[model samples]
Target: MRLLASSLLLLCLSAYSEGTVISKEPGESIHLTCSSEECPTYSNEYHYLYLYYTIDEEAEVVFSNIKSERFSPRGKYESRTKLDIHNRTITLSNLTASDTGIYKCVYKKSSTEKITCSVYAVFITEKTPCSTVSPAVEPSPVLMYIIFVCIISVLAMWILMLLILPKVQQRFIKRRAMHAHQSSADNVYEIMRREEGAQVAAPIGLV
Candidate 1:
């Protein structure tokens, strides 16, 4: 029995010591949780629950269960503080040094008058280094393949035109010369035939 009790006490200590120590800049937000399986449920009504914080040994109210649709967050909050009553947590946005301290959650079970509490400690630092992330992606092979095919097709067309155009032009010039020579030879033969006919018909006896 004593051993069991010792183990339980150690577990509780571990749970208390394992809380987050938020260290963030003034412009950043700090989240603190008072979460445990044994944590109490939030009150549906304003009369049964209260949340507080202790700063410089002075207790300051943080939230009270209220009828106006949300936690009645208090004192320097002014939209800078957020409370999650159901989760037993608080988030302080746009934090300043004055916002650092111990925070608590208090829930009262009305029928039996039972009270449950959870606490968390917060610490704020002056600054931290900036962080950035860049994603890496593999270049697609399809674009490379398309570019390769286009370059080869253009080169092949250029080579074909360079090698074949001069040959085609030379063949055309030779055909034109052959046609001109044949026409000149036909004209000379017609002139000869006409002179022979005229001579035979006119003066055979005198010659």
Candidate 2:
């Protein structure tokens, strides 16, 4: 009995040596395969196949399947895993850093005898931080058109001011000259009237 138990333990330990390492980043998915070759009696007999993994060194059952029947995923793995009994595969999706551990596929023949058919060491890498500086984006055509319109409007206003200012100044100068000529003529007429009045007063004094 001791020899049989020791051989079974040795066989289970040997299964770990043939494990493959799967590396993935967060939010990604991975498929772990367990074909009939891994569990020889899988195709011949209708036994229970279980997907197990370690969490903090404790074994946790992820999925359980029996031949053609539907498999049930346990705990939080219910939403993250999909089991295909026909293909003998289990897919874990939306992976996170916490999912890094040793995953095992076991063939359970009896309550006392369980064989590890395949093993997988899953490693979820940490996400790299994004750069702080954003890439330079080209200005949109609508924005460029608005800027061009604003520049043209300012230039048109300046040109209108330059053309109108000289004409306004010329009109002001012509009005001032006419006002000065009228004032000079009025002053000359007043001086002549005063001189004639003075001459008439002197002749009356002599008479």
Could you tell me which 10 consecutive residues in candidate 1 have the lowest summed lDDT?
Answer: 1-10
Task: Single out the weakest 10-residue window by summed lDDT for candidate 2.
Answer: 1-10
- The best candidate by lDDT is 2
Model 1, runs deviating above 4 Å: 1-19, 42-47, 66-69, 85-88, 110-116, 128-207
lDDT of candidate 1 at residue 136, scale 0 to 100? 38
Candidate 2: residue 181 Cα off by (Å): 99
**Looking at candidate 1, what is the lDDT of residue 64?**
50
Encode model 1's per-residue lDDT on 64-118: one tens digit a residue: 5533436656677757777765555677788775555556656555656645456
Q: Whole-model lDDT, candidate 1?
A: 0.56
**195: Cα error in model 1, Å:** 99
